[model samples]
Target: MTNPRFDVAGIGNAIVDVLTQTDDAFLEREGLAKGAMTLVDEAQAAAVYDKAGPAMECSGGSAANTIAVMARLGAKCAFMGKVKDDAFGRIFGHDIRSLGVHFDTAAAADGPATANCLVLVTPDAQRTMLTYLGASIHLKPADVDLGVIKDARVTYLEGYLWDPEDAKQAFRTAAAAARDAGREVALSL
Candidate 1:
């Protein structure tokens, strides 16, 4: 009813990306599917990360990246995603907030650690990804802020959120709130 306060509200997995340069031989040695994104567990993720070469880490995710870019472009944006009260979680929160994106989802106190995506970039610029959903999959409907959704001109949902039932419900809740407020809903496939 009132003027929207934010241009976009995004919801998706909260992930810290660890990127490393590797060769095809490294991928083959690690038994990684070349240029494919694979879902892995925490231990597996750690194992791969331990073996990776010098790397760079940063906040990353489909919707989160979109929101970050929108904020950088001077659009008021808000983001909702799950994270743990761990190092990576702190980095994620700090990175998004520093970019001027509003993010206030509570961190899980006792669950798994924050999520991370290991992106192995080969010489040809092909990316082989190993993603550990971790705490990001713990997002539930309660994490969806109705006020933010209702106050944003558009609510964007990422397809990755559908992988987790709870996150899926949160996405639905956000979509409903935006629709009820006469706001637009966008989905990233």
Candidate 2:
């Protein structure tokens, strides 16, 4: 029998998307590999932003995105991630909480800026992401809120979270907690 305190939990990179419509030539000029997520530093990320046309910002992180969709359906959710003390970071924080999801990770006072991904939707709707992991790299096992994991019936994680050691460990921590509580774990592709 499930404890049933909550419906679900999720974990993934805490990222914001800066979307831009671009051409293949632009990708070639920027030396970016098409349809792939390449890691870039703050300087490179800024440079790309400058080259890209007017962009729209949105709260998105793999696990967070899944949680967002679930929340839309009136399901309860929780998340774990790291952000900075900057404006974008605050925006990410508020949006998640406003949706009634619990986010308990502390912000890194001085590190890479909040994780931002440049999502390029080509004319064909093909999406290529260039990401700067930023403070999200700081999310560790300690950030995994075990109490929430124990309460939820289904805990969803993103496979891409494996890209970060800390996030991977955080998922492991959450997974362990879920198993201990006899809950189900699902990895979103």
Candidate 3:
């Protein structure tokens, strides 16, 4: 095969992170498990957001973060994930693209809002996270770009993506395409 067009192709959730500074009491009051990542529903996520202090929002996700770092390090990278056509979705796409990572997964026209994580940081520097999967969990096999997978030297899969059935199928599809193209498949646990 000809030389690969990209060094890595990453597949995983597309999430916007909202970080806030708070004390341990706040965590206790909110019933949040300090220093742990917990899955929350949309309502729960909103409740935490509403009750949190000043926050900083940014695009972040396991695979997306890895791809962003790789791109900054001069690696040609691509990312595949699902997001809704909402404000957070726009932010995620724009941020990743600005980092020189190719991200062309179509945003869902009608679905739950874009995924988000509420990160509460205590004085101790420990972070407690509440994540709402939302649209990110809607990634289906069709969302996986076979060409991107085949043209990347490595296809990276995020462990969290396996929780959703559709995303799992998409992950499998990407892995199969990479294997078929004689490329390596890497998983981040």
- Models sorted by lDDT, best on top: 1, 3, 2
Q: What C-alpha lDDT do the candidate models reach, one value each?
A: 0.94, 0.85, 0.94
Off by over 4 Å in 2: 23-25, 33-36, 122-126
Across residues 1-189, which tens digit of lDDT does each residue of candidate 3 receive?
Answer: 879999999999899999999999999998878899999998999998999999988889999999999999999999998999999999999999999999999999997989999999999999999999899989999999999999999999999889888888898899999999999999999
> Per-residue alpha-carbon lDDT of model 2 for 1-189, expressed as tens digits?
655666888877889888999988888899888899888998999899899988888889878988988888898778877889887788889888888887777877887799999998789877788889888777788878888899999988878777777788888889999999899999987
User: Model 3 off-target regions past 4 Å?
Assistant: none
What tens-digit string does per-residue lDDT give for candidate 1 at 1-189? 899999999999999999999999999998999999999999999999999899988999989999999999999999999999999999999999999999999999988989999999999999999999899989999999999999999999999788778888898899999999999999999
Itemize residue pairs with steric clashes in candidate 3. none
> Residue 16 in candidate 3 has what lDDT?
95
Q: Give me the displacement of residue 132 in model 3, in angstroms.
A: 0.9
